[model samples]
Target: MSSSSEEDLLFAVALLANEEEEKRERKVWVHNIYEKRETYGEFHHLFPDLLKDRSKFFHYFRMSQEKFYELLNLVKPCVERENTTFRRAVPCEERLAVCLRFLATGNSFRTLAFSYRLGETSVRRIVYDVCDAVWTKLVPIFMPQPDKEIWERNELEFRERWNFPNCVGAMDGKHVVFDKPANSGSLFYNYKKSFSIVLLALVDANYKFVMVDVGALGKNSDGGIFSNSIFGRKLQQNKLDFPPDKILPGTNELMPHVIVADEAFPLQRNLMRPYPGDESKRNTEKRIYNYRHSRARNTCEDSFGILSKKFRIYQRKMQVSPEHMTKFVLATCVLHNFLREDHPNLLAELIEEATPALQDLRGTGGTYTGSALRIRDRFKDYFSSHAGSVEWQERMINVGRRNTNE
Candidate 1:
């Protein structure tokens, strides 16, 4: 972040040196030579010493150092020690801005180092160390276990809006494209014929990301990824802490709390997925279940889109190694969770406007046409046929109630 910010400042300064600085000075200046060509040059003459001093440039440069510093302080941690080598080596504000720029734009470390006035190795170390410190310090604070109160509030909202109960979060998976690593041709390639990684996430009713699992091979389907994930395993074994198996707040019947997922996941007694079968009756029932299930599950899409669009790192082709890419991804997600919690209104505005029109056109259910009604009827028939099976009927009843409420 520090390096990246410096790069921006350098660009801004370079622009000023060319336009404003050259107009006053009579001599031309070349900032640096690379590949036998002068990279940073001014049209008119300005002494190298004058441009070397940043204060002189800042005297007339349009960039806001204070705003950059203010943003950096919010992201910086107070160093515990007064004399650590890392602390003494870099300025807090500069490093924070560099990291922010890294996330804000997926620029290379070399480019960042030049702009930040730091060694290439230093830039790499700062980014890694700061990212590590942040992940360790902030992930728990921002992404803690969902408390009973939070779950209850979500349940009420789901019941009121989607006819679902005890739905703590909506879970889903999507593929994020990545550059293929050397000699690993088709292994990382997905069904889409693109090199990618799968992102599994769970989000709350408010569309805030609650949990994320990345680094899964893209060949793994959503169900396969979820089934093998730690969260999925915990859910399967009932290892996650849960409330008493009793009715929840403002409801008469026992509230059924679970994560909502798509048909790609397996339907367990505890995990709710759409009914399976190719029969027309079953298909219709599945469609109706999907309609309701999507209402909640779509939050994952919103979360991913917002993170990718806001950070901009995900927008570009990440040039780091696979391991660093994973770290970058996790770090980005954790940071997003923090910003969403700490600066929600700003995040909301960014998300609302970030998605381009073409991207928004892809994910929409045809219209509120008669197809939904047909599925509703099929749902009724399925419930009637499975009347003798108490468990199936109960699940169906929950779906029925959710549909009506929604």
Candidate 2:
């Protein structure tokens, strides 16, 4: 982030370099070539060597060779533009590669320009343009569209994989910090004591983001931000194609399909949060219910973790406009899903351990409907009974009690 921000001060200089730098200074290499180009040059030449050295490939590019090619092919059409009589355009492959490197490292345009043999101004333009293009072309194909069939499939998978029934997706919000924007005082300032925007994401059981809402200010509660988003409005108005209310696996009582979240979101017929207070600790059933709910909701947290640890940009504060940062969120999410589909081994390392930190469980949300409360109760009852209880959930809860000496 510091490297990138320092380069930001030189943006105007980059814009002026072609006219001033060479004019004032005698002779320097016109083409900014660096050592990375020797190895990073061409896929036809480099990819084979990269495949033979998978560890080096993952270290340098942070993706498999095939996955890189897939993304190159995906974004090429959108970012590629033909050159006319003016001159030959920069190759589509180079443009895509530069953007990927920037996203992968959050490196300065200065570093990218020299490393990729392009001018600084050109590198800056290419990277962000490809970012916008990636979001535009690939998002619809990769990010889950909130339709009934999709929702139902996601819910079924959550049940099959996590033993948590009636769950459509695991939803959560992550506050992405950024440097302050010009003339904006504290509108974007968050309780984290940073200027930021939040990315509200919903990932399915398999780690694909089924739904993502970006560009919310950092100051608002997750519930408030969610309630104000377009998806939230559609959700509240029943415009999204949520599955019809259905009976539990063994029970006669019908329950509406819902998204599971931490307590920072509202509990509704269509959204579920965990049981609250000392009762959840003292009561075995409620304790088991909280464990189930948290385990299911942890999918979203795991997805966020995978993204942060992989992308490494969200690991630091982004230095761009909130709107620009939204594009980053969108593109990374789409690419995250695309990579999840294309390369199962990409996130294999941390797949087993994706539990969120205890800090995530700290907040509370709004009062929901009586029906919502009853629906939660119904789930609680079902999970405690033989009809929905996991084979070892009671044992796990008991073990946890022993660990805490409760």
Candidate 3:
């Protein structure tokens, strides 16, 4: 052979040798530390001890041990994986524990992997899978579509607890902040200068989320988001199965069962918002009406506050994709409703810090129907009259004015 041919052969042999060396250096499986997960993992080593202390278990997982097992049973079938000859699959219990711990603390996947003695990639997959399972299994049970009876029950609760006559639920939107996605500019950016997704919810008097519309872009206004949501569409079309109009509790005038919202929502026949402008502040009846409206609408704020306080995932900007973040928020909301049954007074314990008041987002320039305007005026008159007035409403309005003047 010629010298050039011999050199070509030699180069081929050297290239093969380098490839063999690279293959030998590469990791073909997980590290030995992960294989010893049962002996070293927090789920195995620490969770048993946690079960012995109910309070500690609750604090660790943000749910009681009993509730944890109940949730585990519901989600186990979906998250469970069969063992293979290569290795045993991570138990459904451990998968759920990892997911809950991540949500409770909002820790990074790396941090959780170390605690669970699993691969970081494994932790990420487990969290996503388990969150999907939780939402699928629990949403229907905890947040069923309301019927006429359900609407009336909610209305009664609102009247008794909030003293807002003919009210069914309180509606609002919360922004769930997350890292902006690649190749998407200003799509998820909000006025707050953060990238987020909107969680628009209608909450009942007892702080349960009755209906939710998640995964809306953060840049959208609350009114716009509501107008485009399924819940909003149903409400606008009178297909929500709300109860028939009834007489105001102490007045002869008939009124529809309504959802109370802040000024960020449009005024509709069945939706009540505070009257606008300096005139509303100066008019005694409008001031009283606004005060009572605010008192009832606060249930929605308190529900969001309790949810954020308990889950804590919402306290920090999440690092997951918007799709996964939506799953996380929905799962947390399901858990919130589930846990509310066992912890009825949970919201009473947390003191939500006062946030600086934001300018209310006005409704779009669409004209309001005369019927909507009349319904609002009827509520306004009812709230100012002795039949609909609460004893402290006048005092509350006065205090609000005093604060504004100061």
Task: Please give the range of 10 consecutive residues that has the lowest summed lDDT in model 2.
Answer: 353-362
* Per-model TM values vs. the true structure: 0.63, 0.84, 0.89
Error at 232, model 3, angstroms: 1.4
Question: Which candidate, 2 or 3, would have the higher TM-score against the true structure?
Answer: 3
Cα lDDT tens digits for candidate 2, 279-369 = 7977878888888998899898888877776675665565678887777778888888887754456456533333322123227588799
Top of the candidates by lDDT: 3
Worst 10 residues of 1 by lDDT: 357-366
The collision pairs in model 3 are none
Runs in model 1 with CA error above 4 Å? 1-88, 147-150, 160-163, 183-186, 246-255, 275-288, 341-349, 352-406
Error of 2 at 73 (Å): 2.3
* Candidate 3 residue lDDT tens string, 1-406: 9999999999999999999988866645668888889999999999999999976787788888889999999999999999985668999999999999998888989999998999999999999999999989998899888999989999899899988889999988877887888887999988788888888889999999999888989888766888899998998999999888999987779899899988778889898888886879669998888878888899988888778877767876778889999999889998999988664443334324223221123344344688988998999899888788878888887886688889
User: How are the candidates ranked when ordered by TM-score, highest leading?
Assistant: 3, 2, 1
**Candidate 3 ranges with C-alpha deviation above 4 Å:** 1-28, 344-366, 402-406
Q: Which candidate comes out best when scored by TM-score?
A: 3
Error of 2 at 19 (Å): 12
RMSD of each: 15.0, 9.3, 3.5
